[model samples]
Target: AQSVTQPDIHITVSEGASLELRCNYSYGATPYLFWYVQSPGQGLQLLLKYFSGDTLVQGIKGFEAEFKRSQSSFNLRKPSVHWSDAAEYFCAVGARDILTGGGNKLTFGTGTQLKVEL
Candidate 1:
């Protein structure tokens, strides 16, 4: 069984400030990791993913994450955040489950609500 846990339920950041969001997961094997951001009344958009290659993966919208196998963590970071970046962020993991129909199923964390101020 695989599961994801995001420590912070909500976060606030000033415009142009650095940001970091923590994520932890539990899985038998190294699963496919992903980070997604969702705006109000919108679907999730992929930020980045960790499959097999690099430990650190860069994402769209000036975001990046590092996969730490030992710590079972994948934390998202941005050098500077914009006000438009205020939204809900979710950390997800792709794992094979009998309930899923062949395609990868994403197990998402509770979600981290981001609030960016001017």
Candidate 2:
């Protein structure tokens, strides 16, 4: 089974400052990593993903994530955060569908709420 952990429950950052959200994963085999953001009413939006190739992958909204196999972590980062960037961020690990051998399954972390101050 694969799982993900987001240590911080809430984080506050001033506008224009850099931000990093921690995400640690647990899996037996090589894992696919992803970061998704959910606003108050909207569904989750994919921030970034790392399945293979580069360890660092860029996503929408100026967000990027680096997959560290040694550390068993895939942390999300943004160079400069905007007020609109404040939301609930979820870290997820993708798993293969073993039973049917089709599709993919994702296990997400609890989430971290980001609060931005003007």
Clashes of each: 0, 0
Worst lDDT run of 10 residues, candidate 2, spans 94-103
Q: Per-residue CA lDDT of candidate 2, range 1-118, in tens?
A: 7889999999999999999999999999888788999999999988888888999999999999999999998999999999999899999998867898644988999999999999
Local accuracy of candidate 1 as per-residue lDDT tens digits, 22-100: 9999988878899999999999999998887889999999999999999999999999999999999999999755676
Error of 1 at 84 (Å): 0.6
Scored by CA lDDT, what does every candidate get? 0.93, 0.93
- Model 2: residues with Cα > 4 Å off, grouped in runs: 98-102
> All candidates' TM-scores?
0.93, 0.94
Q: Enumerate residue pairs that collide in model 2.
A: none
